[model samples]
Target: MFKIDKRYAKANNQKTIRFTDDLYMQLETIAKYEKISFNELVLQCCRYALENMEPLEKE
Candidate 1:
């Protein structure tokens, strides 16, 4: 399930990442389908991944 955050559009921490064209296209397609900005999609993904990694890191 995906939820939209209205504040995600605001500029907070500005950063740049380089991605392969294929990966960028895939992420863009998913972001479009989810009706969220690409930046929001990446932020959500990074947060999700980091949260899930915490317990594993403890081990």
Candidate 2:
């Protein structure tokens, strides 16, 4: 079994996601440049998107 970080599991319900090589490489580069773990970079992206998302229209 894989060892998961308890903090990540608790905060985000810990799910796995797959990315294309191009996208993954891009994120990897950005993460390295930012000097953060890949997981931390992903988490930051999720938080930013959620915070900036526009509301849906009413039916």
Candidate 3:
């Protein structure tokens, strides 16, 4: 059986997404540059964005 990361499984709720061609190409290039799989590159981006994303404060 395939293994799952405990941290990723914690975010198992279903979600929607759509990526632009430019974004896909950029990620693919980043994956090649880093010598990591495309999926791993995307995952790292998600993790990084989540960590850095700040919610807007309510007025």
Cα lDDT of all candidates, in order? 0.79, 0.70, 0.65
Tens digits of lDDT, candidate 1, 8-32: 6765888888999999999999889
What 10-residue stretch in candidate 2 is worst by lDDT? 1-10
Ranking by lDDT: 1, 2, 3
Model 3, 1-59: lDDT tens per residue?
A: 22222343234455567789999899789777766666665666677777678987999
TM-score of 3: 0.59
Q: Pick the lDDT winner.
A: 1
Residue 26 of model 2: what lDDT? 91
In model 2, which regions exceed 4 Å deviation?
1-12
**Model 1: which ten-residue window has the lowest total lDDT?**
1-10
Clashes of each: 0, 0, 0
Stretches of candidate 3 off by over 4 Å are 1-17, 55-59
Worst 10 residues of 3 by lDDT: 1-10
Q: What is the lDDT of candidate 2?
A: 0.70
